[model samples]
Target: MSSLISTPIAPTSHTLLKPNRNTLLRGDSLLPKRLSCTRTRSSSTTRALLSTTKESVLKDFHERRALKIISGLQNLNKENVASVVTAADKGGATHVDIACDPDLVKLATSLTSLPVCVSSVDPAAFSAAVEAGALMVEIGNYDSFYEMGIVFSPEQILNLTKETKRILPSMTLSVTVPHTLSLPDQIKLAEQLEQEGVDIIQTEGGKGSSPSKPGVLGLIEKATPTLAAAYAISRAVKIPVMCSSGLSAVTAPMAITAGASGVGVGSAVNKLNDGVAMIAEVRSIADSLSLSTGRHIVSEKNTLRL
Candidate 1:
């Protein structure tokens, strides 16, 4: 049986703009007040329907200690795909994230039952990834885009999510809240993604010409933006928020403490020469996260199906 499972369709495109930059608050800020009012005013019947579905939906992937491993950008090479799956399986990674390439998805799905998440900037590429057996999809995993003078603005990222949702409404969707934004902008985009029915919200750090650092200091620096975003978004949205990009074992638990439901570590594991070492690293990170959060890492038997 496959690890990937499909859930019911989420809401269609619904955009709510926060008070724009330079807009006067007039009184105590109204965004949160208004959102709370909306939730409060939602008919009891509607709330009950949502509660029923949310109860069935697993939002605590992190509380369950599911550490998702995103194979390194370098691992997108066709030759490294098998090793990526091997590492993910041995390390107890819930899924692997790959580039939106058909061959990679086919190879990854064939190699493991774990869900495969494909990343790309193009709508066509994301659509292809979903069709090619990717159980989930991500946009704005565009380190390369930043290098080429392309920045993923809030408008662009939200538009991508809207377009992707229109194409694959039933697929699990995780939208990256661009790290390029200031802390406030990141929070707003995250909430927007949540309103647009994003199943997951991911945040990253600096991009393009940015030196990739690993271990403690690097993890802390890289995690700063995503961690802030996670802290803000987790409370703002009902969906899960994941911290990604420059994360490591040391900071994995920190991320959880900062309100992340889970984490997506890319270069930390996939950059290793030996798959076993990579797996071991992932396991250590997962173990650290489990200990810090006081949550038991779900055994394979205990891993609840969505």
Candidate 2:
């Protein structure tokens, strides 16, 4: 009788231990499920935060009077970059664009409150700059490349836009339609980019124009291609069109009149050797945009009264 009781008791103890092991395994499996849920929620929260940031940064664009000052896509000089950024901030410009460098982004951000935009042809390069504090990324800036006889086709630009959107879906993206393309193709590309979720379509034509006259008429002639592009693309798509390249205070308001939501001045401000001159140029463009906006408002009011 004692042997029988002992053997059964040992077997019962083994059964109890086996159930405890199974219970531990089940709890461990549930931990992974809980962790996955936590990760998903964290990702959702992060996307929401980025979306909010994008909206706040683009407020000026939504107002149809954004003045962007470009520090040149190829410009890597920190001193020059600092001067341009300071000019944009003090000169009443709404945004500043610089080369896509993390260090430069940090420098620009440190110098001004205006939203810093980083320009790069490499889609992979934009992430670090954005992480460093850039609020926007531009894919065009094809002027330097054009000088090298390099040009981007419509397919290439579209692919770049798609890749950039894939990499940073929540960040504000501005795609510049190459001035090398015909006006119809430019419009087509702009429409496609808007479908791809691009926030802004920038038109560039500085390199293509050869102004015969050397003054204000020359400026208008220089801006003609970009202005036409802005007008066509703005009407073609609901997205904002930014007229860039070969733009100055004289032609900046003309850009607004021609249907551009904003203007981007690069060589006009970046080409100046003096910081005060850069600021003055930016202020001139900003004042032009301001006056244009004022005139537009009054025109609308008067029309309403009529």
Candidate 3:
């Protein structure tokens, strides 16, 4: 028998968090125009890109415009992770993603009141996170694997999902589908992951993309890979799809329109040197998500080649 222990509750389709609608941003007085200028997206373009026909009911957490701030798995400095985690909670993000190190989990939970989600490729690692107060366990956040020239095959991902479920049978689990596979393959894996009882499926591909356009077009270019995956995966899986990697305030709404219930933003918030800027970026993405959620629109001219 495995060392892991828990009362395996049936998984629900929502994140462990429930963000307040525009709660911190409203208090911060973040303006759409400020976001438009800083992010290189036009408000008119936002309206156009966000306009969509509703296809399904999103999980209740999605209606709140889920934003999860990622403190990179490689980022282990308690002070740095604490800054990101604090900003996430202060800015009204639904949760904070940290390295799956149990000490990091303890450090993160101590910094913020927001629910904690721990990311690691190791299933056995999640047990410590659970003991350290991680509300959810994630088997994928593949961006770190890319710099080392490693790619996760579908079979490996499924095995990880299985092993993770075995270890933390009762913990809320989210798995990421590597964008290395074709869109069809991605959709297929997402369907299978859901069957494995994953509560959420995250999509990542920023490292695989090379944007040719300038300004806002470039921003859209960078986000295309994950957005395409979200579009396909959301349609195929009942579990929520979190569009992550290479996403920005400009493209966050597009992810929501593409069928992602929430977005996992990393560099946008974590890369900032100051907590105030980090908080502003989180609010900007949240604001963008809120404006376009529950309403999906295809732009008049296809902004994305996909």
TM-score of each: 0.72, 0.83, 0.75
Q: Residues 104-147, candidate 3, lDDT per residue (tens digit)?
A: 88888788877788898777667767778877778777776677
Clashing pairs in 1: none
Worst 10 residues of 3 by lDDT: 50-59
C-alpha lDDT values of all predictions: 0.69, 0.85, 0.77
Candidate 2 C-alpha lDDT tens digits along 69-178? 99989999999999999999988888999999999999999999889999988777777888799989999787887776777877778777887877777789999999
lDDT of 3 at 123: 73
Q: Once superposed on the true structure, which residue ranges of model 2 sit more than 4 Å away at CA?
A: 1-41, 291-306
Compute the lDDT of residue 286 as modeled in candidate 2. Answer: 83
Backbone clash pairs for candidate 3 read 51-296, 51-297, 52-296, 52-297
Lowest-sum lDDT 10-residue window in model 1: 1-10
Q: lDDT tens string, model 1, 163-223?
A: 7777666567788886767778888888888889888888787342143675556657766
Best by TM-score: 2
| TM-score computed on alpha carbons, candidate 2 | 0.83
Q: How accurate is candidate 2 locally (lDDT)?
A: 0.85
Per-residue lDDT, model 2, residue 298, is 77
